[model samples]
Target: MGWKAAEKLIRHWKVLRGDNVKKHIKQGPGHEGGIFTVEAPFHASNFQVLDPVTGKPCKIGVKYLEDGTKVRVSRGIGASGSIIPRPEILKMRTTPRPTVAGPKDTPMNLVLEKTYEPKSGKGMPELINILNDVANGLGSSTNL
Candidate 1:
């Protein structure tokens, strides 16, 4: 690789490796300095996803199965013919959904309860009364 290419590769490697360095800006804060970790935007080319079945480096490709489900597959040279399972990190949700209802959660019966009448364009009288009470409480608090 040429100097520019090598430099670019090194920069990418540094970012991926989480290389930390003490940097000082000549323009601002000339003397005061601390270790500043590099931010992301690491190139995808810097790493390769290994094939799960063969344990070999391979390029990914999208393929549809007979069941009409689309999945990632190894396609490039020396690729293993196996369906790549999605990484657990990718499958994970930032906030996982609760499997069981909590005490604060509204009961299914309450959620399914018919509260509105399409024919009269009016909500159930009980809900209206509860809403009015809540509004009154807010108004009283603000007045205080």
Candidate 2:
């Protein structure tokens, strides 16, 4: 086999070995700033999430229990809807988190309407525009 293939094989083997040993991974300060702990090889095969009704692969959604504890539920539609029982197979699974987006979708030009500008001025229009841009968060000092 090529050297690259051999190296890839070695990396895969190491992950498997670590998972086999149940290396603990905790939070705080790694390259990702997570805690230092034992590493475990995680592969989908080891902890499968399947739709109960169709026996097909599915995504899990999280909902809180009546007692306020969190649990995973099947996101599958129709009659396939069901709560996922704690997997008797895998010992651990990370909780799913919602992703968030910022102000990137907001249009900067819309922050100040043209009709609102000073009709005739030497520097008044320019000065007020900059102040309005900063106040409305449409622009910043760094852009200057």
Candidate 3:
């Protein structure tokens, strides 16, 4: 997808990760960050969650930076029964040896079959016209 498309998707999802550093500073003690930040602490490599069925602790996944550096996040239970943690520290684990590709020997044409409809025609035309103008401008400039 293009930049505009990706931006639209982000706007559509409206998933707020957490507050900015400034918000954290201004909010002071009682206000905990968003759900994602609260869940981060439980994501530490050493952190473990008890499995109700087995009554055993299961290790959580720890995410690393692109350079393979371990990310350190702060996680703590606050006075108001809130959990706080660094974004990097929280991670979720996936099943081991998950399927890389779909069923083997499947035809290539059937790879992607998902489609999404526009929410409304309100902003669609404007966005499309803007992009069309930009493309036309680029094409004309190249020929000049």
Model-by-model lDDT, in order?
Answer: 0.72, 0.62, 0.45
Across 1-144, the per-residue lDDT of candidate 2 in tens digits comes to 999987776554424343245433455565343433455655443444777777776777788989998777777444265777775665464664535544675455665545443556543676778888989999989755
**Local accuracy of candidate 3 as per-residue lDDT tens digits, 3-86:** 998766555342333442122223448875543322121113444444334445444334566888664332233122122244
- Order candidates by lDDT, high to low: 1, 2, 3
Model 1 alpha-carbon miss at residue 26, Å? 23
Q: Model 1 over residues 23-118: C-alpha lDDT tens digits?
A: 443445546545555454556564568898888898888899999998989878788868888888977898989899999999999999997987
Task: Give stretches of model 1 more than 4 Å off.
Answer: 1-14, 18-41, 92-144
Of 1 and 2, the candidate ahead on lDDT is 1
TM-scores of the candidates are 0.36, 0.28, 0.17
Return the top candidate by lDDT.
Answer: 1
Question: What lDDT is obtained when candidate 1 is compared to the true structure?
Answer: 0.72
Q: State the weakest 10-residue window (summed lDDT) of model 3.
A: 35-44
> Which 10-residue window in model 1 sums to the lowest lDDT?
16-25
User: Candidate 2: deviation at residue 65, Å?
Assistant: 1.8
* Order of the predicted models by TM-score, top scorer first: 1, 2, 3
